[model samples]
Target: MESQELEFHTAEEDAGLRLDVWLTEKLSDVTRSFVQKLIEDKHVLVDGSAVKSGFKLKKGMTVRVRIPEPVSAELKPQDIPLDVVYEDADIIVINKQKDMVVHPAAGNWDGTLVNALLNHCGDSLSDINGVIRPGIVHRIDKDTSGLLVVAKNNAAHLRLSDMLKRHEIVRTYEAIVDGVIREESGRIDAPIGRHPTNRLKMAVTFRNAKEAITHYTVVRRYPSHTWVRLKLETGRTHQIRVHMAYIGHPVTGDPLYGKKCSLMDTGGQVLHARFLEFMHPTTGQFMHFEAPLPDYFTRLVDLLESRSSGG
Candidate 1:
């Protein structure tokens, strides 16, 4: 793989933003974690000086970034079954199951959505998401189950990514939170950045964080929990989980952001990407697809229904 030297001039509007945060806003295709990796690798420099992700930007500062091509792993096509929701010549949408990593990474080198796409689409998927993620346009976390769309070609990928950046693509999820939400609806408009102490986690920060918005409605209230439907105005990694946790109602079974498993009873985070709506890349028609709540979510509903009915 080769590296490209890229220079980005900060816009006047982007003045006073943190370097890493500014870069993340500019480069929406690549993830924040990947950008942070580049920064830690000394692949990014502000005015030719190596700095941390917290380095604040000044107007007219020329930011140089060395983006190396993702290392191509020898990923063979796997015959994993996919819960495909919709498909056309331009894009394919799938109901991704929980615990399934979207792309090949450190420990998980197979059974990824890429491997399945390679098998299902043959060689038709786009290479825009790098070698590891051949067709993926967006991603949900490993523990978050939901609908995701993959582009079949570069044109589709570019169009879909552009729509996402403009917040034209609507993504919604349903999550079982730890506490009952007293309000019928609410919004979380916090800026999210990497954790100041833990590099692996993300948190809401007054500085160095990107603008995030989450709108949620309480669908069902339990004695100790609430099943909330979430609509994302901005898609950040762990956006729903992090925002919910920040608002004092972490997703039930979320180990990273919430208290221990003793506080809740579920396999993992009870969050599901339930619906996706966007314009068709080729046809220009509005499209919407939904993945039914998984079995575990159904089980929770059954239990909650019983309790709510005074069973």
Candidate 2:
């Protein structure tokens, strides 16, 4: 229950950067607004004195940060079932099923993976991602079923996050698309941003978008659908789904991007985070994980292959 502290020193290259901006940049998982709140609450001090969020940084200035213990009392742990793939002192890899929310949010404050992890790991989970997302490093969409690694401690969390930012963590997904991809493989390099008209959706657009790239190779071809494996070079929000849709091969059952009536009745996109490869954050050894497709996915693929084969 002790408050965690972090110290930072500015360099010549960091001169003139805003205090809040520098904090936000240094704390990879934290947002600028949250950093500003820390400044306003007097939890952030520059050179032993509280400073405004807009205070400009100078070379050799020392900045101290205090991270309060998350108000985690509100999060009650329930005995939710978990499909844990791998566990160590520093990390746990989970094979999350479809329709399972990864963390607590607006309408999904309970029955989330976080709640389940709380019950499972007790106080061993990382607190760097704030209260709701403690221990969570990266996230997949709620409807996406697949593998995700959770850090058990702060050191692991920061290292894993850095791996993701550097694209050193290799993530591969399995997906079924709405149409047949004639070519054996292809790549989609486009900028993706929030849909201008619909805030809830993402689109490939030039306006305030980030560079996104997805490379796909055909796994199998059906009459009207294609099974593919996708690798992300840049992991932006909804990068795979948005890029696939942009290339006219929207993931089947993707309510945000797919056709009104998909090839089948999947509750959501039939994409799974099938593979993860990265170095162990603590031990510095290579680690790899894979989660086989859920029952419904393989069953649907089998049925499609059957029909395509005139069975």
Candidate 3:
């Protein structure tokens, strides 16, 4: 494993941006959390002085970052079943199930989609995201069942990632929210960042936050809940959940962001990634996929309908 060093000189346009936020935007294949860790480890400096992740940048300021090599991941190929929606030589679209983690992380080392892909695709997965997240181009929350596309090789991975960055990929979700949305359709445009006090959760924040947008349309209204379809313009972590919560209509059953509900048995947020549309990485052709709502989500909808009708 080798360490890499990067240097940047802040311009007028980059002024006022937080150090960790700017580095995450400028660096490829790295996350803000990872950059923050580097800062905490004293591997990031501004004008050769070790600074916090929240250090505001100034024009002409020199920033340096030292990225350590990723630790070797002892990932095991699991025989977990996958509901693959579509597959070709370049990519595989999966109708991921609820309660399934996308990739390996601190406490979740096995039974992830990556482990299954390793066994299903063998050595064909792209390594651009390293061993921990090979082939994963994007992710949904563990409780958000939905469609996700996995890249088989580096070329496909880079192209798909670029498409997401340009907002070219279409990702839509269906969510049962806690409140009845008065408007038929709306968009939530807000900046999102890690919560100031709670490092484990994300929130709508202006300081060191990234642009996030979510467009939603009410599909069915109940007395207390609303079924809505949401389209994401930016794929920030917890973007839809945070945005919806910010708008006071948090997704139902979202333990992290919403009040508990007895009408739903869902273990977490009642949000599903139901639609995906993108261009084929190798074929230069358009592709689309739709995943039906899981049993729990459907059951909740039925319950809501019954309650609305006084059944």
Candidate 4:
């Protein structure tokens, strides 16, 4: 179980607004479902009195919330190796390797980023992500290699998550696609949600999907493949892969979305998260970090250059 106390001071303009809406704006990181649960459980109070989601806010009223401890699964910390690129009291930037799962789930309980982080940070990490994912602010897929920023405390987690929502945190990726892309640069703005029949996969669903945007630039091209740099305008699950596949240029060796290729004999698609930039959660300083291309990506580049030169 966990205990938390939150205070919200209402503004004049926010007076008479529903309590749920007020809390949503104040605690932007926690989803509405979570906030509503707090309210329903009588954990949320207006001026020391329990209230419902529809409770009206008063100009000078303060909303206090006390969340009870959550029942979470057991997750033991392991001494897994980590490539820590940056670290401070509030956050850590890791150059995560390919094939390492970012968090624990079914069948992946021990060898995860959370396990490694627990070993690294000891008891200093926050429990905002529950017992399993103590201080995780965001995530990158297991097969995607490169820089990822993790929070160290609840304050830092909330700050970094807010920055992400505001698009202040920037991430860039380099991908090798299966087909030649003629365009020098372009943007793909579409909606993404769970696949209709396949619930495990995400697709560009026309309805009930959230807005997703990706910008791409052709870096180099071979006879049958193209190297591209991608910038995210919105972060959706499997966004880059799904957006590329939607445009008919899925990443090479993308077993889930693209044709299988042995260009560099890599196990997965030739995609890498190359760079990340964001404001520090506590210090408010601008931080930028980059990860060098893995061997397979570099080898693919060499092959492209050699073919371009008729080698």
Best-fitting candidate, scored by lDDT? 3
Q: What is the alpha-carbon lDDT for the whole of candidate 3?
A: 0.86
Give the root-mean-square deviation of each candidate in angstroms.
Answer: 11.3, 14.8, 11.1, 16.5
Q: List the residue pairs that clash in candidate 3.
A: none
Model 4 scores a C-alpha lDDT of 0.81
Which sections of candidate 2 miss by over 4 Å? 1-73, 260-263
| Total clashing pairs for each candidate | 0, 0, 0, 2
For residues 12-96, write the lDDT of model 1, one tens digit per residue: 7667777776675444234557688889999998888899998878788878888776665798898999998888888999999
Model 4 segments more than 4 A misplaced: 1-73
Specify the poorest-scoring 10-residue window by lDDT in model 3.
Answer: 24-33
Q: Mind giving the per-residue lDDT tens digits that candidate 4 earns over 79-152?
A: 98999999988888999887777887543556788889988999878777778778877787777788889888
| Local distance difference test, each candidate | 0.83, 0.86, 0.86, 0.81
Candidate 1: C-alpha lDDT: 0.83
Compared with the true structure, model 1 gives a TM-score of: 0.76
Give the Cα-based TM-score of candidate 3 against the true structure.
0.77
Report the C-alpha lDDT of model 3 over 171-237, residue by residue, as the tens digit: 9999999888999999899999987754446899998899999999999999999999999999999
